[model samples]
Each structure stands twice: as C-alpha cells, then as structure tokens.
Target: MKLKTALPYVLLLLPLAAFAAPGSQSGEIRFTGQIVNSGCAVARVGALSAAQSRQVEIKPGLKVEVDTDRNACGHQSLPISMSYEALKTSTDKGIVTITYL
Candidate 1:
C-alpha cells in the first residue's frame, strides 16, 4: 500500500526533472557557410527571427526567408554582420543557412 501511494508522487516529479536539465525547448538550428553569391537556401522551419553581426562583415548578397509563425513568411536580401557580443544577447530563433559566395 505504501509503494502504491508513492507512485503518484514520483509521477509528479517527472516534469520537474525534465525542466531541471539545461537545453532549449525551442526548435532552432544554426548553419554557417561561406557566401557564394548566387545560390539561395530554403529553411522550412517554425517561428523565425534573425540578427546580423555588426563587428564582422557578412558576405554580400545574402538573402533570408523568415516564414512567419503563420503560413505567411517574409524574405530579405542584404549585407551585414554581427558582433560576437551582440549575438550572445540575441533572441533570434529558427533555421539559419549561410551560402558561400
């Protein structure tokens, strides 16, 4: 009888155990490659956000597709770079593909 009573308590702690682990629940992947000028990469993923590093120069003619949380999406082709310090504080999520030119 005591063993049976403890089962429910054990079950209740499972959720807490999962959260105690360090990692992200958000489904996001980051990929980096050299910018090769003319090819475009498509990332079919979930909610997306982007940040560019200002301290370094991003390859020119880079394009991105930010498919919205909804079925709708947005695209951008620009030149920029992100500072390492800035990247640490960024909340940008989703699939990132870098094409080398």
Candidate 2:
C-alpha cells in the first residue's frame, strides 16, 4: 500500500499505541486494606459495581478509571496496584474485600 493510503490506518493506531505504552498501562491498582478502606483504596466513597471485570497489571502512582459502578462517583483514582485475582473477588454487591502484598 502507498504511504498516503496507509497514513489513515497509522493515524487511527496512534491512540491505540498510546494505550499500549507502559506509561499508559502503568496504572494497575490493587487495593490492600480494611473493608472500610475499600472505598478509598479502590477510591470510591460509596458503593460501586462492576458490570464487567478484567485482569490487569497495575503499577504504582497510576490512576485507574472507575469503569463500572461510576454512578457513585468519578475519578476514583487508585494509588496502589490491585492484584488480578483480588479485584475479581471485590466486584460483588455491598462491601468489596481485597488485599495486596
């Protein structure tokens, strides 16, 4: 394909590339604390629900967007790396219990 023809596809991939970068994916937050702190750890003050779940590698100082259960709040940034296994357990109704090591 000509460079001009391929340009569109390349441009479309920029955003995808950004997300794939380590800097973008560095925000894997695993909440490890009391059930009471699940709010702050996950960083949601109120009850939050996860319609869908995923396994991710969380890094330090990265902000995780509260994809689901955002009805309660927005930008509940998690400053920790939540484990892939523990996050799965915390996505239920009421309190979400979690831990990190």
Q: Where is model 2 more than 4 Å wrong at Cα?
A: 24-29, 32-101
Please list the C-alpha lDDT of all candidates, in the order they appear.
0.41, 0.45
Structure candidate 2, residue pairs in collision: 28-58, 28-59, 29-80, 29-81, 29-82, 30-81, 30-82
Q: Once model 2 is optimally superposed onto the true structure by TM-score, how far is the C-alpha of residue 17 displaced, in angstroms?
A: 0.9
List the lowest-lDDT window of 10 residues for candidate 2: 65-74
Compare the candidates by TM-score and give the number of the best one.
2
Q: Find the 10 residues in a row with the least total lDDT in model 1.
A: 52-61
Give the C-alpha lDDT of model 2. 0.45
**TM-scores of all predicted structures:** 0.23, 0.25
Instruction: Identify the runs in model 1 with alpha carbons over 4 angstroms from their true place.
Output: 24-101
